[model samples]
Target: MAAPEPATATATSSPRPSMRWRVVDIVIASVLGVAGGLVFVLWNLAYNPVTAPLEAFLPGLQALFHGVWLFPGVLVALIVRKPGAALYGEIVAASASVLISGTEWGPLTLLSGLVQGLGAELVLAILLYKAWGLVPAIVAGAGAGVGMVVLDLIVWYPGAAVEFAMIYAVSGILSGAVFAGLGSWLIMRGLARTGALSRFAAGRELGSRAES
Candidate 1:
């Protein structure tokens, strides 16, 4: 008797458009966004207190935690694997955060979310939304981190010294790369293992790995 064929064919061969967002996509995306937003609220409250020691150690190093705010973009992009997934997820999360918990930046938080989400979205677009591997995920996270620091420089720290700005930007990139990129990828793999994402390629890939 022949062994069972792997279920990775549809993912590898399907055209991009065929991966358009479905109802489930919308539902799951919304859930991720809302949950992420709640996390953002809690993180917001804890941000200054948690980072005070790091800031005292090195003024701009607190940006190391910036990735905490950027996870939804990377996570949603990996899970949804469609155009605007990152933007939609991050934007929704940001908006929800504002509505539910309020943020120091007020409406500007929405803009930050949009731009950060765009950063990851652009990376995914460059990959043609076809790849969900570690490299792409890291790139996407770095992109968001870069976008984040740039926005912060303009809006929150316009008068900050060049050295401070530079440190902030670099720290943000590394943090986003690790926390958002690597973290999201790990979370996705875990979800896949649980069979919660069985309908997605991510889950199928995990299954393929196990069978190998």
Candidate 2:
């Protein structure tokens, strides 16, 4: 028989999972979103107090905490491993936040969620949704951070000084990479260790390690 094309062989050997969302996927994703939204509520209450020092030290530095909002998308995508998982998780989370305590951004938070989710979604889509590693997590977080700053500049920081905007962008991106990326990866690892993710590929990866 003739040899298979390289692309065909590669795909056969390393197939990606289904992009379809199953019931379990929806349940777990919604749970994560609600949990993240609860955290968002607390963060909203604390944002002013927590970031007051940062702003005082340097304007736009308060954005250092923006990662808290970005993690839901990354976390959901990491766990669900499905197309649109990031966007669904983020929108659900933002909706939960809005329904619970009402953010200053009001309904606009939904728009923010859409933008941030798309940021992470685009990166995963580019990779064909095959990568689930630290590097990809960090890159996804950075993408979401960039989306955040772009939206904020238009809505929240309109007419902000060039220096302040620049600082905000840097701080936001750094925070997203470190916190959302690293934090979500760690959380997944922890869940895998506990066997909480046995149904998911993330958990199965660790399961083999434990068995070995």
Candidate 3:
């Protein structure tokens, strides 16, 4: 009988992500960033009205909104699969928030966004920017959440209680998981389903799965 083709060879023959950036990637990232920014603006507007009562009842509830600003960053990073994508997306959203809704925190919000975006970006970096699997997504989300807690502790809530701190941290992590990690993953999946991401890992994964 003829020798069977090597599985390794077959696997290697599969398509992989390219290092080069396309015009479409830039345009898509920019659009996602702007859309994320708009969402941030809307969230900012809604936060005060919606969370005011919660803040009055439980001050820790404020952290619930912390992760809201981070979803776009994750989404963009996942889609673009590039360095600095998270940071750019987040900063753009922060700028939009600032332009649309002036805050007493002033420039500090921008700084916070940068820090949080970097947190998630580092996780993707550690993964070598190759895998957007659930584990990495969760880790990225947790990283962003932890970043928010640290930032808040140092700058915004210096004298917070231990219980409140725990609550805040947990809330931030959960929010990151849901809003940033899984949310971004879902968006990628949806885009893949539409065949819009044929050039990326997300697209290839979906394509392979469909082929199987």
Question: Which residue pairs does candidate 3 place in steric collision?
Answer: none
Could you give candidate 3's per-residue lDDT for residues 1-212 as a string of tens digits? 98887786878685766756778878877788778878887887787887788778887877776667778788888878888877777777777677777877759888878888888988888888887787787778777777777898889778888988888888787878777888777877898899998876678888999999
Candidate 2 collision pairs: none
How do all the candidates rank in terms of lDDT, highest first?
2, 1, 3
How well does model 2 score by local distance difference test? 0.89
Q: In the order shown, what is each candidate's alpha-carbon RMSD? A: 4.9, 3.8, 3.6
Evaluate candidate 1 by giving its C-alpha RMSD to the native, one decimal: 4.9
lDDT on C-alpha atoms for all candidate structures: 0.89, 0.89, 0.80
- Using Cα atoms with residue i matched to residue i, what is each candidate's TM-score against the true structure? 0.90, 0.91, 0.83
| Each prediction's number of clashing residue pairs | 0, 0, 0
TM-score of 3: 0.83
| The best candidate in terms of TM-score | 2
Question: lDDT, candidate 2, residue 39?
Answer: 88
Query: Which window of ten consecutive residues has the lowest lDDT sum in model 2?
Result: 8-17
- When 2 and 3 are scored with TM-score, the better candidate is 2
